[model samples]
Target: MRDSSSSSSKPVLTIGLCFLVALLEGLDLQATGIAAPHMAKAFALTPAMLGWVFSAGLLGLLPGAFIGGWLADRLGRKNILIVAVLLFGGFSLGTALADSYATLLVARLMTGLGLGAALPILIALASEAAPEQLRSTAVSITYCGVPLGGAIASIIGMAPLGEDWRVVFYVGGIAPIVIALVLVVWLKESQAFRAQTGEKIAGQGMLAQLFGPGHASRTLLLWVACFFTLTVLYMLLNWLPSLLIGQGFSRPQAGMVQILFNLGGAAGSFLTGRMMDKGHARRAVFIAYIGMLAALAGLGLSTSFAFMLVAGFVAGYCAIGGQLVLYALAPTLYSTQVRATGVGASVAIGRLGSMAGPLAAGQILAAGTGVGGLLLAASPGLVVAAVAARALLARRNRQPQ
Candidate 1:
């Protein structure tokens, strides 16, 4: 009876813990946008400088994802995740305490590293914990925490905190430190990782494993899809509120839109995962990309608050939903031996796009481009992402399950 209960509860526990960490990550990611107006005033930053502020953390994520994922394969996922949580949590506090622009950038960079490292492991842990048939749903469930966390940050931003932007970072930093402690006490190492033989553990070089015969094409396609998909998604995430504010909306009103966006993202993430698990992977992919295109157009064209609200929700639904689909699909592309590494590398490459999105948006906006033009400009990339994603899925379908 004890054995039966333990077996039944293990997956739930793992998924639940991962969900908490993902929630913290989401909060930290969104906190920047939520605090941007105040941060700019506090630090006397320009739009281009603000863009660099956003990208600084993302830059950290690139290396963090690569190195963290690589090490998690050798070290246990639980161990690496704990350290990542602490690293991000601590620096998030640093972000709150930063007195100068340079200090703020360093804090965000370090925080991004932690956030980047934690994500691939979370995906891997959730994927490994669930039954094969339910892997997508499990990952989606874990990922839902992200937008939900973002929603929480939006709520905080809306509060009358006297424009104390540091409040967001303080909350973002402290919670993860607490969660890391809980994880240490309760989180278990991934069962799949423990089951590998010594020979497999000592297997091929990283380059060979990722780029070897059957993997090269899939890896490149995944990178392409991830890069473009994240480019659009992160742009929306880091800039949507600012864009809305730029168009003469009040900060509170923009915060409300941000909240709705995140709530919509949570719903989209959950539903897409369910659809993928029910053998509707193709349909899910189609809806994700097509919906994203329409949402971008809607966001670009909308003038009224009501229309903007609708557009925000749809953008969250499609953009974030599509990202969840990618996260769910990535783990299935490689063997367990290199699963974290593969997922991390894909995430790292995607971070490059994520980094580019904000910086490009900042520069474009600085160059006097309107929100409409900037958003419309992102359309071509989505088309490219859709094509690559479809091709990757088709290739995966042809392989043996």
Candidate 2:
């Protein structure tokens, strides 16, 4: 009794709600970075301490990705998604209330747990809600919200509305609470998720499917590619403004550059995601990796302010856009039976890279590895990701589709 023609149309409403959630995630993700200079002065934080705070937030993400997906499978996606939003909203409030370094750090960790859980679910929902032909485009449509949110954060951080860094956290916390209430009324469980019955059929376990015959190599290469690419992306995201500040720019000026970075991410997400819809996911990703490698090198080498902004934008386009491609590619690697696990595992592994990126960058900065030196060091990671993407393309071509 379903309208087949209706189903063929994209689920605009559903994707819009998911995009809203991602937009909030993007906002919260950059909140700490925007507030870093203020927080550093208030708490007397060294570069190493700031790095720990950044890494602490990401640390929760690794486990949350896996745990959230597992819970979504059993409790239903809507249920888990609602709770994740609530947790983030509540902790973002906590972040605003914190007066001490320790309190702020703890608040970030809690906020991140909610953030980590929400993203994979949103990505999965946006993707599965749409028809097959538009899959990657659907993913990108939802993912675009991230940079859009970051751009908003940049604007807010620089706006004369308030100099208090806590204002950003207040906005982050409150907006999601309102959004979660909206989701409670508006968001539905994914159709694909509902259609799946929790029957124990004869097959390998979820993790086994990832490494099983015909899948092990593809999964492994994707993991390596995801891990390295994320490392580079997070480094830029968590520290770009800080790096600019270190290079002697005012906070507002640095924030402007960061805004450019994310705007590029938004543009790239649309362009590359559309290309993937044409069955160019692998090629688009490989090219993005190469582009990011060049951009990272430029970021380190260029001293001109204009060139720095351009470099940040290009880097954001390539690396952040490339990450979204990985998100899109992950679920397709398995059948519906194994899709959640495959995507969850990939997210979990990628988040581990996220945690490591800020921490390592912190140590590097603390040790006097100048911004140029750090960026140069990071370029090789994109090379590895590019190679892995190319290998995955070849391997998939060889497989019997």
> Compared with the true structure, what per-residue lDDT tens digits does model 2 show for residues 279-318?
8877787669888988888788777889888988998899
Candidate 1: what lDDT?
Answer: 0.91
Q: Give the per-residue lDDT of model 1 (tens digit) for 252-295.
A: 89998999899989999999999999998888889989999998
Model 2: residue 209 alpha-carbon error in angstroms:
2.0
TM-score of 1: 0.98
Best by TM-score: 1
For model 2, give the 10-residue run with minimal summed lDDT: 199-208
Candidate number with greatest lDDT: 1
| Candidate 2 segments exceeding 4 Å error | 1-10, 160-163, 200-204
Off by over 4 Å in 1: 200-205
